[model samples]
Target: MKDMLIDDFQYTAQELLIRNKSILDLITKYQDSNSRVNRAIIKAVTQCGCMTISAHKQEIPDDASLDEMKTSVESHIEGLLCENCRDAIERDIGRNVFYLASICNALDLNLYDIILKENDRIRMLGKYNLR
Candidate 1:
């Protein structure tokens, strides 16, 4: 039963990752564009929560650090998501973290170490997304 539960959680994590990747890809494609359709897509991406018209005027710098971009996008999204959507997104993130922690515990791995390693990898890569 424990194994089955782990498998279920793993599946959920995978599904969430896939969905998140698609959203990130879409965001990447439209984030720097000024096309009307891209603007529409960005608005839709936020589910029309509270994205202000002024938000469309702010442009992400081409030379901004990945962390900067991530922060900007996340802030924008957070501001735009409805209360319920924000809650759901937070819950999903919590679930993913819980699943990862469970797996690390099963393997006797330190979660903090894993986080540091991943942070180093991201720093080396110099590119990351909202997810």
Candidate 2:
């Protein structure tokens, strides 16, 4: 597998965000279920202040119902989001996955190897200096 620079990964992430709608559509169609994607979406959305990471941590009033809490989360995500930023975040997630896959293929290693041998992996990653 070919090596990818960190810059390339960053660039790809940006590109993915720019094409956010397309990525969402694909996710809807494919039902792709990966936690990283979910995390990236949350990270991007939170970064844009569409919602706070600690929204759930807020104290709920005794009068508030479960439905209200759910609604609050939805409203936070949908009501205040920056469309451009959200799109970009989705793209960043896709780019990250692509980068990881490329590295795995190049090294003939699996995800377990990368996670378990992170220091070695980082050293290998250091080989591809930024262009």
Candidate 3:
């Protein structure tokens, strides 16, 4: 069977954008139809943050409470991204990822080390924030 690993594919931001041309086209197509599309993008990003946090902690999301998640996510989106700035959103996420990597490096936590530690913690203690 083929390897089901993300490592098999490599892409730059430009390449990724090119691959997702439909999204760009949709943004352009709906640009004049109010700011609903942009708002949706912001909403998706906020939901991503919440899901990532929940996933790290192995917390099963309450299906019945998704409306609450959406509300919290929207609030977070509003606080972090005002005026629906896509460029700012992209830059912030990129910078934050870089900062996290830098911190991990400074702490001598390589990829393997981090995975092992996380596994151990998950088994023994539990999933808490790294900091």
Candidate 4:
């Protein structure tokens, strides 16, 4: 089940995190992992030439509803990731998740529970959840 997988990943990450047990270390490791993920995405755009970021300001008319605004906003991503870039991005993202789990382990928090609560909040708020 997907729930089991989430818990299993959190537990496995907690068990495997040896050096970065301290909260400070865990936070730093998490930030570094995040940076790696950004770097991978940047490489996909800059080095690999697989994607382009055509970002611009989103100007929504006052008459537009939240639903309309959501639909009209662009992600700015121009192309799909190539296989190599996808693999690299996935790996970096996995590392980011690992560090996040490690942070939760250090703080005596449950990553699965956190994710569940977040999902619940999103569903409850729906379009009202601006962030």
- The most accurate candidate by lDDT is 4
Instruction: By lDDT, rank the candidates, best first.
Output: 4, 1, 2, 3
> What is candidate 1's lDDT per residue for 80-116, written digit by digit as tens?
6556545655655554465454455445566666666
Per-model TM-score, in order, reads 0.38, 0.30, 0.27, 0.96
Better structure of 2 and 3 per lDDT: 2
Worst 10 residues of 4 by lDDT: 14-23
lDDT of each: 0.52, 0.51, 0.41, 0.92
Candidate 2 regions off by >4 Å?
1-48, 55-80, 109-131
Per-residue error for 64 in candidate 1, Å, reads 15
- Estimate the overall C-alpha local distance difference test score of candidate 4: 0.92
* Candidate 3, number of clashes: 0
lDDT of model 3 at position 73: 38
Cα RMSD for predicted model 2: 16.1
Model 2: ten consecutive residues of lowest lDDT: 24-33
lDDT of 3 by residue, 27-120 (tens): 4433433345444455545653321112223333577364454443322222243444555556555544433333344344453455567778
Q: Model 2 Cα displacement at 54 (Å)?
A: 3.0
Model 4 regions lying over 4 Å from their true place: none
Candidate 4, residues 1-131, lDDT tens digits: the string is 88899889999998898877889998998899899999999999999989999999987878999999998888899999999999999999999999998888888898889999999999999999998
